[model samples]
Target: MLARGQNVPTIEQAADFVERRRPEVATLLISRSVLLGSADNFLKSFPGGTLYAVKANPHPEVLACLGASEIAGFDVASIEEAESVRTVCSSKPLHYSHPVKATASIRDAYKIGIRHYVVDSEVELDKILACVSRPLSIAVRLKTPEKSGTYDFNTKFGLHPAESVPLIKRIIDAKVEWGLTFHVGSQCKHPKAFSAAIHVCHSVIENLGKMPGYLNVGGGFPVAYGQERSDLTAYFVEIKAACSRMPRVPLLCEPGRALVAESGTLVVQVIGRADDRVFLSDGVFGSFGEVNYSKIQMTPYHLTRASAVPSLAESEFRVFGPTCDSFDELDQRLLLPATIKEGDWLIFPMMGAYSNALASRFNGFRLPSVELID
Candidate 1:
C-alpha cells in the first residue's frame, strides 16, 4: 500500500514491490490523484481567465486533465508541442508564443489556425506579416530587464517599451490587428515581479493611446521545490490592484511549472551500495533537470520485510546513478531514515515538470516507463 504522508515512501517496500511486479521493468508513476487536485485548485484561484502555458510538463494525461478543467488555451513553442496539445485537447485557442520566430514555424502555425502570435523584434514582426494571411491577433512582447530574486525573460525576446511604441504604430499603420504581452521571467518567487510587469503593461497601453483586446502576462509563477512558495492569491490580488489603475482589458496568464510540479514523483531502485553510498538504477540525464536544473532530493524509507520499529533517527547518505559519467550523481548527501540498504526503493517528489520531458536514453538506460494513477 502507498504511504499517506508526502515524504514517507519506504525504500524496502518499494524495492520488493518493484521486484515482485516486474523485475526487469522500471517506471515513473505519475499521481494523477495529486495533479487533479492541484489543477482544480489553480482553476478556482484564477477564475474566468485563460491559461495557455504548456512549457512545463506536457504529459498527455496531464493535458487531458487540464483540458477537462476548462483551461482556455495553450501557449506552445514548437510544432511538436502544438500537435501534442491538439492531440489531447482540441478547440482551445493556441498562442504561438515563442519569441524567436522562424519562417517555417510561422507558416505551420498559420496553417494550424494559430492566430495569436508573440513577437519581440521588427524582424519577427515582418516575418509574421509576410506569412500570416488570416485575421491575426498579435502581442508585442516588451523587453523588461531582469531584477534580482526574479526571472529575466528579456534576454530571449521582447522589444524595449520605447521600441514597442513604434512597433505598435507600425502595426496600426499597416492595419494589422495586435495586442501586448510580456513575460516577467520563469519561476518567479515574488508577486512584485508580476505586478511590475503589469505596471509596465499599463504604461505601454497609456503611451500607445489604444487598448488591445488582450494583455498576456506571460508565465513565471513558481512551484514549491523544498519549501512552500509565496501564495498565488496574493499575487493575483496585486495584479488586480495594478490593473485597477489602468484601462480595463482582458487578462491572460501562461503558467507552466506551478500547475504541474509536485504532482509527480520519480522512483528509482537502489542497484548497488558501498560504504553508505547508494547508486540508483536511473541517472540524472535519464529523467532530471530539463527545465529546473537542480538535483532531486531523495526521501528513502524502509519498504521490504519489516522488523520491530527502531528509534526514529536520521543519517546523511550520498546517492549516485548507474551512468558511467562522473557527473551523473543524483545527490551528494541527503538526510533520511538511518536504516536504508541495498535494493531499496528511493522516491523523489516534485519531479512532474521538466524531468521526464527532457530525459534521454544516454548510457543505454531505457527511459523510465510512465503510468498515471488517479
Candidate 2:
C-alpha cells in the first residue's frame, strides 16, 4: 500500500499527466463498491466466518470498505498489519496467521487483543506461550500437496500431515482452543484442492481421537484473472460440502486475492514503443510485481484513447517496466493495440491482489497514483 496521503489523479482529466510529469508512473483504479460487493458475497455464501487476509491489499480504503461490509475478522501476517486493521475496525477479531513470528510481534499482538494464531512448529508455540498469559486459540498450518494454484505458497509455510500430527498433539496437551488450517495455494484453480486438504485435517483429527475447535480453509480462493475457475457460488458450495465431511466444528477462511483482485484495475501509460515492444511507466518492481506470468495471465486489459478510429486491433508485444534493471521486465508478452504509443493508457483489470502491496521504490519509482472510485 502507498502512503496514507497521495495526490489523486483522474484517468480522463489528467490522462496526459504521465507525459508531462518528470518521473513517469502508472495509475491504480480502485473501486470501493466492487471491494465491498466481494465482501458481501463472501458473507452471504461462505459456510462459516470470513476473515479478510490483510497481506493481499492493505490499502486503508480497501480495509475500510470491508469493515463497513461487516467482515467477521482479519488474517494479519504481522503485528504492524494487526495495527493497520485496527485503524478501520477495532471490534472485529484479528488472527495472526503467519507461522513464524518474531517474539516482539507476539507480545505486541497480545497487547492488541489478538487471541488467534497459526503455528506449525513447537518453538513458535513455546514463544506464544511465554509471551501471552491469556488463553489463546491456535490453528495449525497444514502443508498440502494438492497444487492447483497460480502461486505456490506451501514451500515457505505450512507443515506436512505427519509433522502437523505432533504439533496438534502438543497443542491439545497445552489445552488451548485449537484448530486445523491449510492453504492449497494462492489463486487456487480448483475447489477440489480445498476438499482434499480438509480430508487430511479430518484424518489427523480421527487419528488423534479429538476434534479441533475449528478448521480454517486458508485463502487460495480463485478470482477471474484470465484463467477459468469454478463459479464463486459453486466454489463455495463445493467447499461447504467438503467441510461437512470433517468433524463438526466451526469453519473459518482467510481470503486475500479472491476478495480484492477484481476490486481494482491498473492503468499504465505507454512511455514509448519500439518494434514489437512497449515500455510502461511501471514494472514488476511496482504494481505489476505479482504478475509473475507471461502474457498478463488472463486478466482483462484495454486501451484508453481519445479516438476509436485505430480500432481494437490486438497485437502481442514485449512489455518493460520503468526500472533501470533489465530483469524488471514482465514475465510474458502483453496483448495490446499495435498502434499503442506514448500517452496512450493501458488499463489492466483484476489487479488488486499482490499488485500495489508488493511494489517498491527501486530506481526511484514507487507505486503509481491510485484513484479510489466511490
Question: Total clashes, candidate 2?
Answer: 3
Candidate 1, residue 96: how far the Cα is off, in Å: 0.8
The alpha-carbon lDDT assigned to residue 191 of candidate 1 equals 78
Query: Which residue segments of model 1 deviate by more than 4 Å?
Result: 1-26, 148-151, 290-313
Candidate 1 residue 45 Cα shift, in angstroms, is 1.8
Displacement of the residue 11 alpha carbon in candidate 1, Å: 12
Pick by TM-score: which candidate is best? 2
What are the per-residue Cα lDDT tens digits for candidate 2 across 164-241?
Answer: 888888888888889999888876878778788888888888888888888898888876555443257766878878
lDDT of 1: 0.70
Q: Write the per-residue lDDT of candidate 1 for residues 45-92, one digit (tens) a residue.
A: 762465756767777887887777767888899977888988988788
Backbone clash pairs for candidate 2 read 225-299, 226-298, 294-332
Q: How does candidate 2 fare on TM-score? A: 0.89
Error of 2 at 6 (Å): 27
